[model samples]
Target: MGTQFWVKGTVLCKTGAQVVNATGPELDKFIGKISYGLFHGQRLKQCGLGGRPFRFSFFPSLMEVIPASLHISVIFFCSVLIVFSSVASAFFMYNAFGSPYETLHGPLGLYLWNFICCSCSCLVMILFASEVKFHRLSEKIANYNESTFVYKTYTERFDRSFWIILFTFLSHTLNILLIRLAGIQFPFQEAKEATVNTGASDLMY
Candidate 1:
């Protein structure tokens, strides 16, 4: 055979892991600034998780999910309550001085307060509904889009009064429920019964 050279070699390789530590003031500062909120800086701390990586669950609890029909019925009931309360309050306030017998005496002040509250509640609800329905319509209008408008419009601003009215309505409704739950009859009911009895007695006489 002619001069031929063959080379065969075995190579051994070693793998090693490296550890890096991230501990510094900069990292700590970054973590401190990370937070979650409905609005900026209004951090919501719940369920032991509050940070940039917001942890959210669609159904956090079983009670949160309700049937659509039941939900609609509840909303309807609430609407009826708000409407009836508002109407009653307005009627009582309008006839505040006209009829003492029709309007409960001691609770006249209460009715006046209720009137003010319910009026405000209705106004707030109407304003909100209008905003939702008419805001887009207004936006499509040429006049409303002008940059030179002098005064600010109601649609442009969120009135804090809305929240006030909402809370008032909620509390008013709750009070009514509480009264019913306690089995306490309204003064108006007693007045009506008394009037009926008096009329019967007069007829008998």
Candidate 2:
């Protein structure tokens, strides 16, 4: 009698079939190559049990998706949004503790505004970090490897939070642009000239 050794495992596929039979050696080699692919940030193509092949691609980094010429503009806008959001959040927090805002808007309203601004700022920061750090790429790899094999080339899309933060930022930027377009100066600047004239009139008197 001859002895035989057979190692068996399941190959997960996203489409067509859920489970396919695979040998231990094949699974080992496939997993080894996948580890290397993940380390080098490379796409992987592997064949499943039934001779079905699947491709896995990582999500492109932000810079890859964005043009170099517009890089500075993007950075500038993100920074401005972050700063303004932080400042607005702080202002709201301060008002939450005080008299006029507490009486008029109430603590809840002030706190709500504060939370929105703070959350928007934090979410923007996280998005910026993910852009540089390839966090989404890692996530894609994990998701594809979990219980299903991803077939198509991975495409990166902005999440809802990203759009929300972007819209908020753009709205604030538009407000500033409109003020400048309308030739509106700060109240302090308008008061400065009045103060100077009043001082001169007092001197004359």
Candidate 3:
């Protein structure tokens, strides 16, 4: 979450034709590439004719410029993803190498944990994407603390880190299918079968 970014994009703005002091007419263009990740907030690389190319971090510096509530929500879901993924891993390890309970610590537990991790990963991607698109995140980050010029999103796309979470979701889904392939009945199916067997035995008695 902290290492890589979910979305990367560039913002551009064109300066006004005339200046107040007026050395000469000026129409300059500015462009900045911004990358937004979970923990590190956003990164900006300014490459424009108006100023020397530079780089900066947005969090704690321009933190107020972005939507705080939605950002926090993304972070929350990512944290949940990490926690539940770890729990699912531990359950897998125990189911393979250690003595497990018949129900909670068995196939049912594995399914439950994997499902949770999958759900959280999905939510992380959805919420982060929503924050970027609906909130106009790129434009906000580009225009932060800038009074002289306004910036517009020139290009935007999801980065590798975002797809990594998607792969994580797929992996959990695969694990669930593998559990079924191992000939273990789903919890509900197992319960229905047990109830039917019990009723048949009662009738025989």
TM-score of each: 0.29, 0.30, 0.77
lDDT of 3 by residue, 78-197 (tens): 888898888778657756666534323244565777888888888888888888898888787777777876668868999999999999999999998887776667767666445433
Candidate 3: where is the Cα deviation over 4 Å? 16-29, 41-59, 99-105, 192-205
Ranking by lDDT: 3, 2, 1
lDDT of 2 by residue, 1-205 (tens): 0011111112223332324444555443233122212112333344344342334322233234333333344345556556656665555445446544233322223233334444554555454445433533333443344454544222334334444555675665554444445454433455544543333312111
Predictions in order: lDDT? 0.34, 0.38, 0.68
**Structure candidate 2, residue pairs in collision:** none
Q: Report how far residue 184 has shifted in candidate 3, in Å.
A: 1.5
Which candidate model has the greater lDDT, 2 or 3? 3
Choose 1 or 2, whichever is better by lDDT.
2
Q: Against the true structure, whose TM-score is highest?
A: 3
Q: Which candidate is the best by lDDT?
A: 3
TM-score of 2: 0.30
For 1-205, candidate 1 gives per-residue lDDT tens digits of 0011111111111010011222343222212111111111111111112232223221222113323233234334345546656655665455456664444333334333454455555654664445324542112221122253211111233234334446777776665554445443454565544533334312111
Candidate 1 weakest lDDT stretch, 10 residues: 1-10
Q: List the residue pairs that clash in candidate 3.
A: none
Q: Give residue 156's lDDT in candidate 2 (0 to 100).
A: 35
